[model samples]
Target chain A: MIILGVDPGLTRCGVGVVEAGASRRLSFIHVDVVRSDPHESQDLRLLKIYRGLCTKLDEFIPDAVSIERVFAQANRNTVLGTAQAAGVAMLAAAQRGIPVALHTPTEAKLAITGNGQAQKIQVERMVTRILNLNTMPTPADAADALALAICHALRPSGALQGGEREQHLTQAQRQWAEATRKANRGGNMLHRGM
Target chain B: MIILGVDPGLTRCGVGVVEAGASRRLSFIHVDVVRSDPHESQDLRLLKIYRGLCTKLDEFIPDAVSIERVFAQANRNTVLGTAQAAGVAMLAAAQRGIPVALHTPTEAKLAITGNGQAQKIQVERMVTRILNLNTMPTPADAADALALAICHALRPSGALQGGEREQHLTQAQRQWAEATRKANRGGNMLHRGM
Candidate 1:
């Protein structure tokens, strides 16, 4: 299956698309950073990122998308930015009907280096070794994205199975659904004018 | 100044835009929830959110945006979704040349109710009392958004100052600036052939 991987950020997102099959072979489809102008409004910048991401999604047409799960304790702004990036990546995958999977950084490291605490360099080395690349992945973000994808590839399918995690209902959606269900159940009563 | 507040989430985001003056009087400009369809791809849902936010930014023309910060936790998927929503909000503000601010949930509660440990309902009541809304804000998300705005208003000027608390680069602009500075310094050093 074609797997798309993403390392999300507000201004810069690293994306990598790889083709994988029975032989454990990987062919790089794409890798790049999506950015926005600093002087622009936050809304416009967000739009730019969205558009850029959509373009990437369209181009890759991957069977699955994998993203790194951020688990960091930092400043409020930093955390906010990271969240936004992750949201965009998730949204992109959801829009295209592609199955999406998430990998923790630690899991990715462990999968690659047999150590959850492996450093960036170690992970990079393992990625290069596993993928058999002549040169290391340019930009750490791209490497991280690849690692996330690799982690997903190694995960149990059931572990990545999808359905609504929480009940799939907005407050309004829930209210409407409940009302409709009630109406359906009470149809005989309504017909009898009771 | 006009301040937009956002309570980011994976499924639904509560957004509030309010104008606050030096006298602390507040005017509600708009309030709503940005939602995504679960049946759709996550990426597309995020794009919808990004576009919706952009439209709001255009309509309100806020001077700054305030968003809730996500904390590091074991819930990897939740954290990822929250981060993406936060990123969309930040990009929206930044693109508009509006500065963005972030506050922890406790900081916002403390600012609104003088009690960091205040419950959600308690914070909502305080927000209603503080803003003198005609009625309690419809959904808790909207109330939380207003609370974030209030927190930003209560903060001292430049209270949400931009700087890397741990390193030196938090936002893209800051990172670019740092890179430029280093480049210029390196150029000067190169002129001396060192």
Candidate 2:
């Protein structure tokens, strides 16, 4: 199964796509950064990010997407931007019907470096070792994203299977039923008033 | 200036547009809900949100966009969905070059009801009174979004003035300059190797 991992940020988003084979071996397929145009308005910057994300999705076409979940942080602005990036990643995956799984930073770090509070350099070193890369991944963000993908690959529940999609469809159906009921009730009321 | 408020969610997004006059009097221009088909993929849901937002923008042509900043809560899944909704809203505003501002729930509640912990009913009542509505806003989410827009308007910082585009441009220029410098340095290294 091919899994795409994303480290989301407003200015720069790091994406790493990995293909997992038998015996949990993960192979790197692609890695890159999606950047927002700094010269554009904040709205335009977001658009740039969205477009960049779409391009990445089209290029990688991973079976599943794994992204870092927003952690509780003191900087509200930073958190808001991070959340926006994560949202874009999630939406991109969801739009394609690719199941998305969220991994916390600690979970990824622990899975990669065997330590929850591992430093960036340590995580990078372990990521290189695990993925058997020729050189250290440029930009710490990319390395972090790769680590997230590897972490998901190591998890028992990480692989994209058919059962998960079925569950999602079932849940969506229930929600649709509820919304339809509400809409019918509103329509009935309007007709009665008329 | 006209400020558009958005309360984003997975199923329904509440939108309200209010025109802020010089005397601080507010006029409601539009209020409605943007919804998505439950059976759609996550990407389609985001697209639905984007299209809906664009329609709203085209219809109202507001000067600024104000939205609730997603707060980290107990349910990671719910927070993720809220963040995605927030992203769609921000992206929609960014695409239009409209300045966007984010307000916390407590901040919005305090601005509308004079208390941070005010109940939803109290907030709805205050919103109705403040906007002189014919009736209380349906679906408290819409009322909350309106309250957020009002809070942003009344803020001393003048939240509606656009900022992201200019900063992005400056940053992009700086990055370009840095890249040029790096290329020059790399040329020197190549000359030494030759």
Candidate 3:
């Protein structure tokens, strides 16, 4: 199963594509940041972001699109722009009739680094190690996008609305779930197999 | 000049089209509320609103699009959806290369009723009088939209970015400005003519 993850922002939107193989092994397909000029008018900026996402959607054609859920409680200045960016991402996915899922930042962190409150560097490191990339995904937004894709790919069948949910854990997924349990023994952070 | 005004919302988006003639005379072209099912997914709802706005932009072929500017300081529960709706409105207009202008509710109220804090009914009454309409625009949203259009039409040349700005105030605009000054003697709430 292939998944497209979006870390939405007005000035810089991060996108990552990932594919899941048997036993839940993951491979990276693509990653990039969609940037728009901050000096441009709001309408023009939104149009650029929307068009960029539409192009990505057409090129990747992923099975599911995952976006980081933004909250109003975030920074008052950036929340509006963030929400607008996410809206365009959802619109792009919906235009193509692709299923879109929203995952919180915490969920992405927990799935990646086995710590809901993991620092950005930690999450980045885990994403690098999990995907076996020689170089880290530069910029925190890019790493966050990959984490969202990984989180959605590893989610249990019941947690998802109507998408593919692997029944068995691949060796790599098992190791990650074990790592999560090892990191938080008292907490119930186990994946489905565990 | 023809102007399309949008009072954006997730469930019920209000739209109004107005034409500006010589002497700043305003004629109502059309007004309606575009609604989406709340139970539907966010993406689909946004798509419906986007498509609805696109249709209006195409049908009316307005020279300018005016939208009520939403603030993040507004209702927490509805602010996100409202921003998303506004985003779609801007997107639709930008896609067609239509100039878009944002008017705050306070600005609309001041322009329509000479009172920034004017109540809904007062603004509605003033809108009816300004347009010489036999009936009041039903639903506060619809009236608010018309007020936005009127505000854009009556705006001074200096205030607008690149759209046509009338050098002289129409008779109706003069009366409205006079009324505004009369309503608040101590306030400098004058339109360009005053």
Best of the candidates, lDDT = 3
lDDT of 3 by residue, A130-150 (tens): 899999997777888898999
Model 2 RMSD, rounded to 1 decimal: 14.8
DockQ, each predicted model: 0.19, 0.18, 0.30
Q: Of the candidates numbered 1 and 2, which has the greater lDDT value? A: 2
How do the residues B5-110 of candidate 2 rate in per-residue lDDT, one tens digit apiece? 9987767889988888977888877788888875665556776887788899889898888887665442444554566677788787876778887666666766
Off by over 4 Å in 2: A21-25, A36-45, A73-77, A110-119, A158-194, B1-3, B8-12, B19-27, B33-55, B58-61, B69-84, B103-123, B129-132, B149-194
Local accuracy by lDDT, each model: 0.67, 0.69, 0.79
Every model's TM-score:
0.59, 0.64, 0.84
The CAPRI-style docking tier of model 1 reads incorrect
True contacts kept of 3: 0.56
Can you list the residue pairs that collide in candidate 3? Answer: A23-A170
- Best-fitting candidate, measured by DockQ? 3
Per-residue lDDT of candidate 3, residues B1-194 (tens digit) = 99999998998999999999998899999999999887787889999999998998999999999987766667766777888899999899999999988766766776777666789889899999998899999887788889999988976544223234333555444444544334334221111111
lDDT tens digits, residue span A1-194, model 2 = 98888998878888888899998888888888888755444456667877887788888888878887664332434555676677777777776778887666666776676666779899899888888899988787788888888878865331123344435433323333333344334332111111
User: Model 1: per-residue lDDT, tens digit, A154-179?
Assistant: 54332223245215433433333333
TM-score ranking of the models: 3, 2, 1
Model 3 chain B poorest 10 in a row by lDDT:
B185-194
Candidate 1 error regions (>4 Å): A8-14, A20-25, A29-64, A70-84, A92-99, A103-132, A138-141, A147-194, B36-48, B73-80, B114-122, B158-194
